[model samples]
Target: MRITTKKLVLCALMTAIVFLITFTPFLQIPSPMTQGYYNIGDAAIMIAAILLGRKVGFIAGGIGSLLADVVTGYYIYAPATLIVKGIEGYIIGAIANKKNGVPSRLRQAVAVTAGGLEMVLGYFIYQATVIRMINPTLGMASIIADIPGNLIQGAISAVLALVFLTVLYRTNTVKNLLR
Candidate 1:
């Protein structure tokens, strides 16, 4: 697909939205398990994917999350966050926007589930391997401790995305946005 000015603007807007939502002081809930904090940025990422499609989703999610990590001083996890969140956004958009028009509820559900699982697994693997390698002092126990928080984050993100999508659809916002 050819890139247009409109698409570029939308992607930039979405990226800013994701970063702002993620880094907002009140929105970030500090995780008791690890240095990571849970935020609703994933909700915006998923919504962007479902609305704008995969390419925009990947770019916005990856860069936005990367910026959030850097600004938040989680430098160690920035690379992993970029890859993981990028893939998560791509997966959601690819599945949810597979067809031409607005996605069916089943498709949206599957997309969110698959994307959320990808995020959870991606972070788990990243923390288990790369994080362990970088800081051997952080043991497996700490890695395991992070799972529940990630799972909760993913679940919350999924719910928020679905509810937002439902509202957009009901209000015909999706129709206008797609056009």
Candidate 2:
């Protein structure tokens, strides 16, 4: 695919935004369930998906989240973060842009909900199986305990994303530039 200067620039900006948002110290709730902590980086991921299309969202979300994981010294999670965030971004963008125009409120809600669930499920699956394999002592019970934290993280991110998106939608400036 030929890259347009516009797309290149937007992708770069969005990627930077995602990285900054993910890297910055956000409200983190410590989970007793596992080594993982819940963060609101998903809010930024949702915003990127809403502003950009699927391809750009996937690239920005994946690389940005992967970099965040590396920078945060969570290197073990970088690979999973890449795939999970990429899929999350793609799902949001695909649902939001379903009509090839302005996304409806319902679509936006669906996108956020699905994307949030994707993140929660993706990490859950990774931690439950893959991490369990790395450490045979890890039990399914311990992994299952993380569900509540993940659910809380997902819910908060969705609310944050919805609020941000709503404000952006109201201001035609950003919306116009996105188009």
Candidate 3:
């Protein structure tokens, strides 16, 4: 597909939106179990994917989350966040937009579920292996402690994204954007 100025602007806007949503002090809930914080930024990531497609989803989600990590001083997780969120965005967009017409509710649900699972599993693997190696003091048990928070974050984000999509799909502006 040919890139357009509008698409580029929208991608940039979405990236900023993701970053702002994640980095805002009020939006973050510090995780007692890990260095990470839970935010609704994943909702923005999913919305970007569903509205703009996989490439924007990947770029916005990865870079946006990476920026949030850096700003929040979670530098160690920046690289992992980039990869994990990027893949999450791509998975959602690819599955949700597989057909020419708008995706059905079931398709959207499946897409978000798969993406959320990926986020949870990706962070688990990263924390369990790389994070464990970096800080040997954190045992396997400690590393595993973050799973519930991540799962909850994903679930909440999925619901928010679905609700937002449902509302946005009804608007003429979003319909035009999709086309």
lDDT of each: 0.88, 0.83, 0.90
Of candidates 3 and 1, the better by lDDT: 3
All candidates: TM-score: 0.95, 0.92, 0.96
The TM-score obtained by model 1 is 0.95
Ranking by lDDT: 3, 1, 2
Residue 21, model 2: lDDT of 77
lDDT, candidate 3, 1-179, per-residue tens: 68989899999999999999989989999876667788989999999998888899999999999999999998998999999999999999998994576788998899899999999999999989898888888777866888988999999999999999999888887878756
lDDT of 1 by residue, 100-168 (tens): 677898999998889989998999999889988888888889888888888888889889999998998
Which parts of model 2 are misplaced by more than 4 Å? Answer: 98-100
How do these models rank on TM-score, best leading? Answer: 3, 1, 2
RMSD of 3: 1.2
lDDT comparing candidate 1 with the true structure: 0.88
Best by lDDT: 3
